[model samples]
Target chain A: DAGVTQSPTHLIKTRGQQVTLRCSPISGHKSVSWYQQVLGQGPQFIFQYYEKEERGRGNFPDRFSARQFPNYSSELNVNALLLGDSALYLCASSSDSSGNTIYFGEGSWLTVV
Target chain B: AQSVTQPDIHITVSEGASLELRCNYSYGATPYLFWYVQSPGQGLQLLLKYFSGDTLVQGIKGFEAEFKRSQSSFNLRKPSVHWSDAAEYFCAVYAPWGGYNKLIFGAGTRLAVHP
Candidate 1:
């Protein structure tokens, strides 16, 4: 089966602009989570959705939002993007919100200039 | 707050040599620990996880980890390192909040293998 897949593998955005990254969870997976990885840093949790409901959110600002669809796909949106927001946005999928078997996608690289 | 720490920022090893990456975690209760490896420009891949059971857990790609409750550490080890094993290794803990859970990851250790 295919693993979690993300779109727009790489993109460039201007400051104060908005960007959206999409993710398709693996078949039969019900949970999708978002993470951000700065250069030379590990991935940090941003948000998680299960069954089309927000389950958990990290320390990100209100400018960042995410939603899951009926098919278990997800989209992460960032408004008023800042230069600091440039990073690799990763999407992970698990069997459930509480399962320990999470898998990550290749991630979408966003560069804010 | 729950957190993970990887003491070594980078490590260099020769092929066919044994390798060890140190990881320390702080949590209120028993922690669900995991080790993930990421190649350049790629995503994270689960190497192994320790929830509850034997302290020593074997993972894919000739990797293994030992969880020490006393030291609050879960270190990844490989008996014989290969050139392809060079990547960033991360130590993470599953943090459960209410009915949901998320992973808290360490800064990660970059491994370089010499021929």
Candidate 2:
């Protein structure tokens, strides 16, 4: 089975612009989480969705949001992009029943200028 | 909120030499610990995990970790390092609270292997 997949592998945006990164969970998985990995740092949690419901959120600001579809696919949105937002956005998939082992995607690289 | 700490930011070792990467996690509950590796331009891959076991767990790619509950550490080890082992290693703790599943990761330790 294919692992978690993410789209728009690379993109560039300017201040005040908005960007959306997409993710598809592994087959039969119903939970999806988003994380941001700044250069030289570990990934920071952003949002988590389970079964199309918002389950948990990280310390990120209100400009960041996410949602999960019925098919377990997910989208992460960042508004009013800032230079600090430039980082690799990662998506991970897992199942609540299958233990908490998460599988991460290649990540979407976003650059803000 | 849970947290992880990796004391070493980077470590260099010669090929065929033993390798040990330190990881310490902090959580109130019984922690679900994990080790992940990320190569350049690649995604995170799970090396191993520890929930409740004999403290010694084996993972993929010739890696192993021993969970010391007393020390709150889960240090990863490789008997003999290979050149291909150069990568960033992360220690993570799964927060089993609020019916939410998420991992709190450490800052990560970058490994450089000498050929």
Candidate 3:
């Protein structure tokens, strides 16, 4: 089975532009989470969606938002991008919202100038 | 607030030598622990996890981690190091937030292997 897959493997945007990253969870998975990994640091949680419902959110700004589709795919949106937002955005999926082991995607690299 | 810590920022080891990477987490009660490996410009791969029972747990790629509750540490170890094992290792704890759980990771320890 394919692991979690993310789209737009890489992209660049202006400081005030907006970007959206997509992720498709593994077959049969129902939980999807987003994380941002800045260079030289560990990943920080952004948002989590389970069963098409918003389950949790991280310390990220209001500009960061996400939603899950009926098929368990998810999209992460960042508005008014900042240079500080240049990092790898990772999408993880699990069996459910009960804290199962999460599988991560290759991540979408976003660079803001 | 919950946090994870990896004291060593970087480590160097010779091929065929033993290796151990330390991890410490700050949390009350026993927390779920995990170790993940990532290659350059790659996503994280789960090495191992510890939930309950047996302090010693084995994972993929000849990796093993022992969970020590007294010290609040989950250290990853490998008896024989391979050059391919050179990568960044992160320690993470499953933490509760809002109404669900999420992973909190450490800064990561980068391993460089000498051939």
Candidate 4:
């Protein structure tokens, strides 16, 4: 049983560019969430999706969006990235939107210059 | 709103010594608490959780936590620390807001173990 997996482990983008991070959840998982972790800070909630529907969103701006597929995989996209957007984008998977038994992926390190 | 606080930014301890990490939470109802550990450049790993039942819960890697509703705290503890125990410890609480259950994490405490 593999855990949640994320890709583009490290990336660099221009301040005005856009970026997308992907995640694959555990086999039986049905919920997927995204989090952002800045340097020297803990991970903060971003978005959560269950059954291909947006269940909850954090305090992030409209520039950030996410979608979950039928297979419970997810993608987090950030548009017009700014220097402040440079952080570790983490994807977590849980059994459901109830937030029970969630697990996290290694995360994608995004650096905007 | 639900929130967590880790008063200690960093803590250093010697190997074979007991360790305690303080965590305080603010929530309306009985809180669903959890402790997570993250190594450098790694994702968060579940150390333990307190939902209901016994106040003291034992977790993997010899870690344990006790929930005290009176104090609004869920502190992580270990009987003996190891060099590998050096990592960032986070306290979190599950909240039901925006029609979905979410996790709110603390600022995190960095742990350093010395020989």
Chain B TM-score against the true chain B, each candidate: 0.97, 0.95, 0.97, 0.98
RMSD of candidates 1 onward, in order? 1.0, 1.3, 0.7, 0.7
Q: lDDT scores for all predictions? A: 0.95, 0.91, 0.95, 0.93
Candidate 4 TM-score versus the reference: 0.98
lDDT of 1: 0.95
Candidate 4's docking class is: high
Per-prediction DockQ, in order? Answer: 0.76, 0.64, 0.87, 0.82
Question: In model 2, which runs have C-alpha deviations exceeding 4 angstroms?
Answer: A97-99, B97-99
Kindly report the interface RMSD of candidate 1, rounded to 1 decimal: 1.4
Prediction 1: B-chain TM-score: 0.97
* DockQ of predicted model 1: 0.76
Give, for candidate 4 chain A, the lowest lDDT window spanning 10 residues: A94-103
Tens digits of lDDT, candidate 2, A27-55: 99999999999999999988888889888
Where does candidate 3 chain A have its weakest 10-residue lDDT segment? A96-105
> Candidate 1 docking category?
medium
Candidate 3 regions with alpha-carbon error over 4 angstroms: none
Model 4 lDDT tens row, A1-113? 99999999999999889999999999999999999999999888999899999999999999999998878899999999999999999899998777588889999999999
lDDT per residue for candidate 4 within B14-78, as digits (tens), equals 99999999999999888789999999999989899988999999999999999999999999999
Better of 1 and 4 by lDDT: 1
- The Cα error of candidate 2 at residue B101, in Å, is 2.8
What is the overall TM-score of model 3 with all chains considered together?
Answer: 0.98
DockQ winner among the candidates? 3
